[model samples]
Target: MLAGAPSSHMSSSVSTSQGIFPTSRIGSGESPNSGASSFTQPIADMNENDETDLLSISWNQDYGCFAAGTSHGFRIYNCEPCKETFRRDLKSGGFKIVEMLFRCNILALVGAVANSHYPPNKVLIWDDHQSRCIGEFTFRSDVRGVKLRRDRIVVVLEHKIYVYNFTDLKLLHQIETLANPRGLCCLSHHSNTFVLACPGLHKGHVRVEHFGLNVTKLINAHDSQIACFTLTLDGLLLATASVKGTLIRIFNTMDGSRLQEVRRGVDRAEINSIALSPNVQWLAASSDRGTVHVFSLRVRVSGEDSLTQPNAFQGPALFHQNSSSSLDPLISPNTGANPNSSLSFMRGVLPKYFSSEWSFAQFHLPEYTHFIVAFGSQNSVIIVGMDGSFYRCSFDQVHGGEVVQQEYVRFLKFENRPK
Candidate 1:
């Protein structure tokens, strides 16, 4: 039996000082960093009876549901009810699921064996409610990621991204990349630019392009593996978490400059997941130590537009300047005429830490938070823990519109997005 009831709370406090940069600091800020924050109570929790590792998860925005892919198959949960709505209903294939995603109402599940030596490849699409396999695709090589675009379904494989037309599943494009790629993120909001991440033995690099043809920016960002990452909806901010250490770095998505580095989970444990709120005002990270941390972020919008140097926060500052001599031409060149150099101008575009005070709320889970995601347009958070537990919690947001009123207004407006 689980020892604790497994509850989660939101506790936050914002404090501003002249600024002290601890080598092991978990969070940072700029001048005039007036912190503000709020918290919420744990709403509900559900458990899946799995002993193996839980791998991937996808949130069904329209249906108010979420699904988690585990070592064997996959488990489905209803975020509204905070319970396991279904278990391993459609995953009958022999391979283990590595990734899962939901577009509209359709669910996609992908997985591969690590040491099997065989090209780890399997794809299955299941009906959400019926929990039945509606479609399946098996490839020769392992699949890295599955990205759903309004116009296409992108499948990331070894060094290549296969783009299939969403309407017909016909191959439309194939993007080639550096060998042994690790991360993939779609930059749809910025003129079809897709961000590709690949970390080497000693450093990390990110590329921005579309159809795998155009190379916009390539910069080395990290030292070890990038554990979890996300880009803001506007493609202005990019957040990356490290697996080698408990550090989260916020970068200017435009040029890949370090904006703020958060060290909160470094000593606690490895962070397994990170979520960027829809408004880009908050960030949530799930740690291996059975805790989910919520941070408030308020971007310092500077009025200056000069390009001589990268724009920085308007408040107290803490900079991570590696020996200026060791910087790479990709990050800092000798001539300074590098177009990529000024890319740091996007630094102050996204909020990193809350302007108000906030504290980390600990959730003693039946297990650790394996994967977590926050819902769009809602103040809801969903966490899937290692002990097969799935928890849902809602926070108090005064700025969030009233649900009853917004729904009525939306229903009455009858305005279509754009035909």
Candidate 2:
């Protein structure tokens, strides 16, 4: 699994290794507020930064600073007012994956297109203040992803995972898996620490590792290949999707028991991402099909702790009837079983109840069908596209149905300079 806690939650210095990026300071510290009601920006005056394209973006929950990866390098932006306080560009080319360490200057960057200094097969641990890579780790194949916690660093290769100590860069542990090009992994910094989830040796199975306990469990999650997954903030709950994309399953991480499942849709689709809210009360997901669904989650509890209730939560759960009803000419009646769909050719008709599990709320944007999703200020959902555009939408808690949204914030056009 990837890192769960945010960089904003951390202090200025990550570890004794080096200082934080000081050249890119923004007054006291004001990134965009995740709890803001909405951002009313003057888009007409906004201008794109030097970087031409944004390949990846991630937030440091500990620092409230976000790094946007571009062909040149990456820039650090403060969230509240959303300003570009620091910028780092790769003279060689574009960076594919950018993983931020908790509030530390150290960051893991992989997947380079043009830059030779940082190769695609190597993970570069960069110290922002020094503007130099202090350490590097090599892999036999292309590195798919990298993750950082306060104490350790995780790198994901095509089929292998390597864990290293934060200060020494020592190889702590390594895992082998089936073909995992997406670098699907999640880490939970919850009540415990370093709980990880990734694809197992068998397809659709999830290997959950509690690093603190040195224990591992593989859950028979789905029959199809796992698409994407995420853990609750505390690492107690797990949410996963199969290539099928219609169903999203939640499990109790402690015992690998099914907690609950939500439907993304009745038809088959390619899931881009699945995220549980900070509160774990809501789940947001996006698919290449151009739909973002936010479903209300009900986690039953005995007292202060959420209990793991199996089988009782089973059966088709409906978030909504397909928003694009079959009766509507504009809506494709048969999306789940298209012969061209990724897993559509599998035998047998999908259960009629499949249509019942739909997204309670859907973001209808044809252009941003493939965008990445996150929860933002005031529990609003943040949608960012590959083209460098992002939008923030406020979901009504008491009254929820069709998703209500505003125009994209157009991050490329906006710039928050340090004073």
Model 1 regions lying over 4 Å from their true place: 1-56, 60-64, 70-75, 83-95, 98-105, 111-120, 125-138, 170-202, 210-215, 300-369, 375-378, 394-419
- Tell me how many clashing residue pairs each candidate has: 23, 39
In terms of lDDT, the poorest run of 10 residues in model 1 is: 405-414
- Which candidate wins on lDDT? 2
Model 2 TM-score, 2 decimals: 0.74
lDDT of 1 by residue, 350-412 (tens): 343222123233334433435454543454665654434455665444332211211100000
Worst 10 residues of 2 by lDDT: 310-319
Runs of candidate 2 with Cα error greater than 4 angstroms are 1-46, 49-51, 61-65, 300-355, 367-369, 413-419
**RMSD, candidate 1, Å:** 20.2
